[model samples]
Target: MSKMIKPWIKLIALIIALPILSYISLRVGVIPVGHTDVLALGSDASSQAMIALNDNRIPRTVVALLVGSVLGLAGLLFQLVTRNPLASPDILAVNAGASLAIVLVTLFGFSSIASFTSAALVGAFIAGVIVYLLSANGGNVMYMTLAGASLAALFSSFTQSIIAYEEGALDEVLFWLTGSVAGRSLALVTTLLPWMIVASLCVLLISKELETLSLGDQVARSLGQNVGVIKFVAVTLAVVLSAFGVALAGPIAFVGLLAPHLARYMFGTAFFARLAGSALLGSVLLLSADIFGRLVLFPREVTVGVVLAVIGGAFFIYLVSARQGVFKS
Candidate 1:
C-alpha cells in the first residue's frame, strides 16, 4: 500500500495539470485568442475568441481526452486478457474495423454520426470475433497478433481502394485516417459521451475478474471464475469503447499501446492501480499532444495523431529492443 502512494500522487498531479495545459494551449493558436480574451468575453475580438474557444478548441480537447482515456482502458483490457503488452486495439484490428466501417459509410454519402457509430460497432465486433477465433485455436498470442495484423492490413487495403476510386471521399477519409480533432463539432462529443461512460462502468466492473484471470486460466477456473464469460465481456466492452472512439475521433493510435505500459511501469503491474494510472496518463498524453500541435504550428494546426505516431514509433522501437522478454509468460 505504501509503495503505491507515489504513482497515485503522480497520476493525480497529471489529471490536475492537463486542463491547465489545455487552457493555455487553447489560447496560443494563430487566431491569437489569449486567456484574457477567454475570460473577458465582452469586446468584439474577445467575443469571437470566446466562440472559437468554445466551439472549436473546447470540443477538440474534450474529444482528445476522452478518446485517449478510452483507448488506454481498452488496451489495458486487451493486454490483461492476452497477457501481452503488445496487444492493443489498433494492433488487434479493432481500429481497422472501425475505420473500414466509417470509410464505407463515407463512400456512400452517409455522414450521420448515428450511422458512423453503428457501423463502427458492428465492424469492431466482427473483427474482434475473428481475432478471438484465430487466437483461441492454440491459445497462442503470436498467432492472434499475426491474424489481427493480417486482417487489419486487408481492411486497410480495402479502405484505400475505396478512397482511390472516389475522389470526393478523399478529403474526409484522409483526415479521419490520419486521425484529427480539427473541425470536430460539439455534437461529436455529445454523441460519444454516453457510450464512453457506459463502457467505462463495464470496465470497472470487470477489473477484479481481470486480475484473477491474470493469474492463469487454471487458477481462475479453480477459483470459480467463468473464464470464457469474463473474456467475452471484457472483449465486448473493449471493442465497443474502441469503436466509438474511432467513430468519433478517427483511428488515433499508440494511446492504447503506450498508456497501459506507462501505467504498469509506474504502478508495478497491479490491476486497479494500472487501470487508474493509465487512464490519467492517457488523458495527459493526448491533451499534451494536442496542446503541442496547437503551439507548434500556430494558425495552421497539425493533428495529435501525427505527433503521437512519430513519438510512439520511436518509443515502440526502444521498448521492443530493451524489453524483449517483458511479455513472456
Candidate 2:
C-alpha cells in the first residue's frame, strides 16, 4: 500500500504546496494585500498596492515559475545527455553566453526585450556548438566542463568590462546581472509565456528519447535511436529554454542543478516523473525565495539572483562534498 501510494503522496504534497506558496506570495509583500479583502483593492488606498500586486508581484512570481521550470528541465536534459550529474545550463556556458549578449545589447543602449532575447538565443546556440565540438574529441565531460568554464569566465569578464567602461549604463547592467523581478510588467509576461509553454512541451515530448539515451550510446543505438540526432535536438531545445529564461530573468543559478537532483531523490529514475517533479520543485523554491526576500527587507526588496546565489552557493558546496564519488569518474 505504501509503495502504491508513494507517488500519489508526493504529487499531492507538491500540488498542495504550489498554490499555497503562490497565495502567500501574492499576499505577503511590503504592502499587505489581504487574501479576503477586495475592498481595499477597489479603494484609492489600494491604488499603489494594486499596481504593485498586478504589475510587479504577479508577473515576477509567474516569471519565477517559468524560469525555474526551464532551468530544471534544461539541467535534467544536460545531465542525462552527458551522464554527468553536474552538467547544467550554466556549466555548459549557455547562461554566460546569453548574459554576455544581453550585456552587449544594453551597452549599446538597446533595451528592447525582442533584441535581447534574439541575441541571447543566438549566443546560446553558438556556445552549445562550441561545447559540443570541444567535448566530441573523446566525449570527455571534464574537458567539456573545463572548456565551458573558460568560455563563461571569458564572457563574464567581457560583461564586467562593459559595465566598467559604460558609466551611464552601469545601473542597468548591475540590475540585470543581479537578476531582479522588481519592476516587471504583465506585458513582459505575455511576451515570454508562449515561448516557455512551447519549450516545456518540447521537453516533455522528448523525455522518452532522453530516457533511452541514458542507457549509453551503444545501447541507445542498438535500440534504434538516432543517437546523434536525438542528442542534438535535446541539447538544442535545452539551450533555447535556458536562453529564454536568461533573457527574461537574468542568469539564475542552481535551480537547474538543484531541482533535477531533488526530484530524482524524491521520485527515483523515471525521466518524466523526475521532470515534472523538478519543474514544480523549482518553481516552489524560486517563488519561496522571492517571497522570503520581500519579507526580509520589508520596503526594500532583494534581487532574486542575490538570494539564489547565497543559497545556491552553500547548496552547491554541500552537493560537491557529498557527490564526490559521482564526479570522480
Candidate 3:
C-alpha cells in the first residue's frame, strides 16, 4: 500500500498546488489582478487591472511556465546522456551560448525576437557540440561538468565585455542578463510556441530510445540501439530546448539543474514519469520564484533569475557537499 501510494503522491500534490500558485501569480503583482477583471475579459471592460492581468501578468506566467518546462526537460535529457547528475544548461554553458548569440544580435542592431531566437539556436548547437566533443575525450561526468563550467565562464566573460564597451546596449543587456519574465508581451510567447511544440513532439518520439539508452551504453548496444545516433539526437533535442528557454527567459539559472533532481527524488526514476515530473516541478519552481520576487522587495522586485540563483546556488552547494554520489549515479 505504501509503495503504491508513493508514486502518485507527488503528482497529486502538483495538481493541487498548480492552480493555487497560478492564482497567486495572477493576483500578487504590483497592480492587483482581481478575479472580476479576469472574468470580465472579452466583455466591455476597461480598467488598469484588466490590462495588467491580460498584458503583463498572464504573459509573464506563461513564459515562466514554458521556460521552466523546457529547462527541466532539457536537463533530464542532458543528465541521461552524460550520466551526470550535475549536467544542465546553467552549469554547462548551453544558456551562455544562447545568451552570447542574443547579445551579439542585439548589438548589431537586430532586435527582432525571431532573429535573436535563430541566433540562439545556432549558438546553443555549437556549444553543445564543443562540450560533447571535449567531454567525450575525458569520458567522465566530473571532467565534462568542469569543461562545461569553464566554457560557461568564457562565454559569460565575452558577454560582459560586449556590454561594458557598448554603453548604449547596457540597459537591454542588463535586463536580459538579469533574467525576468516581467513586462514580456504575448507576442514573445506566440513566437516561440511553435518551436516549443516541435521540440516536445521530438522528445515524445525519441523517449523510448532514451529509456533504453539510460541503461548504459553496453546494455543499450546489446539491445540493438545505435549509441552514437541516440546520443546525438538526445543532445540535439536538449540543446534546442535549452535555446528556447534562454530565448524566453534570458538564461535563467538552475531550473535545469534543480528541477530534474527534485523530480527524480520525489517520483523515483521511471523515465517517462521523471520527464513529466521534471516539467511539473520546473513550472512550480519558476512560477513560485517569480511570485516571491514580486513580493520580496515590494515595489523594487528582484529579477526572477536572481531569485533562482540564490535558491539554486545553495541547492547546488548542498548537492556537492552532501550528495556527492550524485555524480557517480
Candidate 4:
C-alpha cells in the first residue's frame, strides 16, 4: 500500500481523528464516565462521574497531547540535525538523562513541579550534549545510536541503583519512572505549558535555518546561515522539548522515534507539513495507546510507556532488519 498524502489533507484528517479519539478515551476508561458526566459539570452538586472527569480523565488526556506533540517535534529536529531517520530522544538517551535528573532531584526531597521541570531541562541538555560530542561523526546511524544507548545504560544503572537504596522514596520514584500520563494534574499542565510554548516558538523561528542546515554544513555555511549557532540552538531546543515531555510523563518511549516516520511517510517531509503531521499523529498515537492501556486488561491498566516501548522495540528491529536486507526476500 502506498503511504502518501497531501500535507494539509493528512493534517486535517489527523485533526479530526484527535478529538474523536479523545472523546472515546474519556468514554472508555475503567470507570463509567461519559459525555453526560462531562456535561454535568455545571450542576451545583458534584458527582463521582464529574469528579473523575475533572480530576483524572481530562488531565491525562491533556498530558498525552502535551507529551506527544513535543516529542514528535523533537524527533523531527533530531532527524534533521543528525540526518538519520532513527534519531530520536529515546534512542539517543535524552529521556533517560531527564529521568536520571528527576530521580536525583527526588532523592534530595525537592518535590516541587518547578524543580522537576528545571532538572529535566538541564539533565536532558547535558545528556544530549554528551551524545552530540561523542557522536560528532553523527551521520553514521549505528555509531550515534550506540553512543546514546551506552549513555542510556549508564544513566539507567544509576537511576535503578538509587531506587534500590532509597526505599523511602520508592513509591514516588517508581510511579514516576513508569512513564504514564494517567496521574498528572492540571497544575502541572499550567506549569509546563509556558516552557513548551517558548520552546515551540523558538523552533518555529529557526525552522528555515534548520531546513537550510539539513542541506549539509558546507551548503548551509555557503548560504550564509550561521551553521554553528543554528546547530547549537536547534539541538538545545530539541533537548528542551524532549526533557519537558519526560517531565510530563517519565521516559515514555517511541513517540519520538515512531511519530516522525509516520509523519514523513504521510506528509512528505516539507518541514511545516511534517511538523504539523508529526504533532497530530503523535497525540493520536499516545492518546490511543493510553485508551488501549485502560481497556486492554479491563480493571487493570498498563502504563502508556510500556505500550509504546513494545511498539517502538518492534519498529526498531524492523528498521534494523530492513537495513540488513532481512525484509528484501
Candidate 5:
C-alpha cells in the first residue's frame, strides 16, 4: 500500500505545483507588475503592467507549458522506441530536421510561424526515417546514437551557413536558433495547438502498446502485438510532438531526455502515469527555467535553451560517465 500510494502522492504534488508556478510566471517578469492592482482594477500605472502580462507574459507561459508537455511526452516515447534513456528529439536529429526546415524558410524570405511549423513536420519525418534506417541493424543503440549525433551536427552546420549568408536577418535567426519563447503570442499557440492535441491523442491511444514494447520485442510479439506498426506509429507521434516543440521554441534540449527519467523515478514503470508525471514535471522545469532566465541577467533576458543547455550538458556528461553507454534497461 505504501509503495502504491507514493506514486500518486508525487503526481498530485506535481499537478498542484504546475498552476502555482504558472501564476508566478505571470507575476514575475522584467517589468514588475502589481498583481492585486492589475487584477482588481485598472489604473494608469497598472495599464502598462497589464499589457505586459496579457501580451507577453501569459502567452509566453502558455507556450512554455504546451511545448514542455509535448517534449516530455515525445521524450518518453523516444526512450521506449529506442530503449535508450538518453534518446531525445534534439539528440536524435528530429529537432535538427525541424530547425533546418525553419532556417531554410527564413532564408528564403517566406517565413511565418505557421510555415515554420509545417515545414518542421516534414523535416522531422524525414530525419526520423533517416535515423531509423541508419540504426535499423538489430536496433543497435550505439549506431543510432552515433548517427543521430552526426546528423545533428550536419544539420546545425546547414542552419548556421544559412544564417551567416543572410547577415541582415542574423540576429532574428540567432534568437530562434538559441531556443526561446520570447515574442511568441497566443496566436502562435492557437495555430500549433491542434497538431499538439492530435499528437497527444495518438500517444494516448498507443499507451498500452508502448508499455508492452518497452518490455522487449519478443514479449510484445508473444502477446500478439504488431511490433512494426506500433514502432512506426510511436516514432511518428514522437516526431510530431518534437517538431511542434522545435517550431514553437527552436530546439530546447534535455526537457525530453530529463523529463521521462524524472517521471520514471517518481511514478515507476506504469506508462500512463509516467507520461503524466513527465508532462507535469516538464512544465515545472521549463516554466521555472523561463522564470529563472528572466531574472538571471536582470533587465537582459537569457534564452531558456541556453539555460537548459548549460544544465543539460552537465547532466549529459554525468549520464555518459555513470552509465558508460548502457542506460536503465
Candidate 6:
C-alpha cells in the first residue's frame, strides 16, 4: 500500500515539475528571455532574445529531455539484460566507444552532428558487443563491471591519444568528449528521431518477454520465451538508443545509471511502470543538472555532463553503502 501510494506521489510531483523546469530553462539562459520575447517569438526573427530562444534555448531544452529519456531507457534495458543495478551505457563502455568513433570521424573532417550520430551508433554497438562478450561467461556483476571499466579505460585512452596528436581536432570533439548538451539544435535530434522511435516501440513490444526474463532465463524459457532473440534485440536497441543520445548530448553520464534505480524506487518495480518512471525521472534529473549548471556559475556555464558526473559519484557512493554486498567476492 505504501509502495503503491509512493508512485502516485512521485508521478504527481513530476507532472508539476516538468513544465516549470521547461519554462525556467527558457528564462534562465545566458541571454535574457521574457514574456515579450515569448510572445514575439515567430513574429520577430531579428530580436536577439528571440533568436536565442528560437535557435539555442528551445533546442537545448528539447535535447536535454530527449537525451535524458533515451539514456534512462537504454540504461534500464542494459540493467534488465545484465540483471545488474550498476550497469549503464557509460559504465559499460558504450558511451566511450561512441565518443571515440565521433572523435575519429571528426579528425577526418566529418564534423557534422549528423555524421557523428551515424558514427556513434556504430561505435556504441561495437563497444557494447565486446563488453558483453567479455563478461557473458556467467560472470558476477563485479566481474562484468570490471570488464566494462577496463574497456572504457582503453577506449578513453585511445581517444585522448588521438586528441593529443591532432591538437586542432580537440576543439571539435571537446564538448562531445566531455559530455554536454550545450549548443545542440533540434536538427541534431531530427537525424536520429526515426530510429529512436523505432527502438522505443520495439522495447515496448518485447516488454512482456523482458519482464519474464527478469525472473531469470529459466523462467523465461519455461514460459516459451525466446530468451536469446529477446536478449539480442533488447541489447541492440539499447545500444542504438544510447548511441543517438551520445550523439545528441555527448555522453551525459549517470542519468542512465541513476534513472532506473530512481524509477524503481518510485514505481515499485513493475517493469512497464518502472520504464515510464525512468524516462520521466531521467528528464527531471538531466534538466535539473542543466539548470543547476546555468546558475551555479552565473554568466559562465558549466557543462551538464560535469554536473551529472558529480551527482553520479555521490549516488554511486550511496549505492555502495546501501548495497554493501557489492564488495563480496
Estimate every model's Cα lDDT from 0 to 1.
Answer: 0.81, 0.80, 0.86, 0.85, 0.84, 0.85
lDDT of 5: 0.84
Candidate 4: tens digits of C-alpha lDDT, residues 19-74: 88878877777678867776666575477777777778888999998899899889
Residue-level lDDT of model 2, residues 3-91, one tens digit each, is 35476578679868887887777787777676654335444454666866776667787888778888888888888888877788887
Q: List model 1 lDDT by residue over 1-329, tens digit each.
A: 64757766876777787778677757766666776876764455636678777777777778878888898899888888887767888889999988988888878888788888899998899889888888887667668778888988988898888888886766767777888766777786897898799898888877899889999988999999999999889888889888977887888888888998888888885667788777777777888888887767766778888898888888777866787785453
Would you list the clashing residue pairs of candidate 5?
none
Q: What is candidate 5's lDDT per residue for 190-256, written digit by digit as tens?
A: 9889878888888987889999898899999999999989998998889999999988888899898
For candidate 2, give the lDDT. 0.80
Please count the clashing residue pairs in each candidate, in the order shown: 0, 0, 0, 0, 0, 0
TM-scores of the models, in the order given: 0.92, 0.92, 0.94, 0.94, 0.93, 0.94
10 residues in a row with least lDDT, candidate 1: 38-47
Pairs with steric clashes in candidate 6: none
Error of 1 at 249 (Å): 1.0
Off by over 4 Å in 5: 1-4, 37-46, 325-329
RMSD to the true structure for each prediction, in A, is 2.4, 2.4, 1.9, 2.6, 2.3, 1.9
* Model 6 weakest lDDT span, ten residues long: 1-10
